[model samples]
Target: MIQHKTLIIGYGSPIRGDDAIGPLAADALAAGPLPAGVNVISRHILTAELVEDILGADRVIFLDATVDGEPGEVRVRSLAPDASAMSTMAHFLDPRELLAWSQTLYQHEPEAYLVSAAGAFFEYSNYTLTPAAAAALEPMIERVRELIATN
Candidate 1:
């Protein structure tokens, strides 16, 4: 029997206060026990190189910080490849853009989800999360775990 591969990528700016939640959550997950065929990666940013890694997985989960909702809000949303979801920055690529690259190059795209935590502050700080973001971290991680278990 073939084991399904699930890749969890947590990416954000480590120095940008609550923006560090993604990598922090990834690190927390990595330091614990996980089921077989599951891999966790903590990245400072998402880039073109990740498309190769993403292509190898059957499912992918992206964890990040968002400012669109109330502070400490945790949201889980499905993701799809959108060629139009281009990033203005040349260094970091959006998760959707990476998916699009995999689809264009390999003709296959894994099921993807984005688990985001609403952050109150994104100012310059060294891996520190604001009160709201810190409180939402566990929920974000739990949501990812539930996703892994259910789908």
Candidate 2:
């Protein structure tokens, strides 16, 4: 029973094979039976419009699919708003840049975390996760649940 406000943004493209992991994970979390106020969103990317939502939350978790590990590897790390990090493009923002924007523009700095899964493929495909990515879901879900529990 987490009383703190929490927001989870799952970003990735459904057509991009292993990238479908984020949205799928988001959907799973959204349907969970947890007793907490968890706002879940699935997006193709992050943008400035998300700042307001970030401002309203006590904590923010950004879930992204990456190529930084084995197909289903999961990494969760704390985030700080980097003073020098700024968006070169108005439309998209990585987690760090978005945190920096929230701190600088809105004068708010919610505790932030990035929970990412390594992706095996990014080519066009139907809404399907690669075998390794699929196997990764249970662990990812457990990790998310543990985060809320311990936070």
lDDT of each: 0.91, 0.83
Tell me the lDDT of model 1 at 140.
Answer: 94
Candidate 1 local distance difference test against the native: 0.91
All candidates' TM-scores? 0.96, 0.91
Question: Which RMSD values do the candidates have, in order?
Answer: 1.3, 1.8
Tens digits of lDDT, candidate 2, 1-151:
4487888888888899888788788889988786467788888888878888898888888888889988899989888988566667757887888888888898899888888888888998667888989988777877777777765
Query: How many clashing pairs per prediction, in order?
Result: 0, 0
Could you tell me which residue pairs clash in candidate 2? none
lDDT of 1 by residue, 53-106 (tens): 997898999999998899899999999999899999869989999999999999
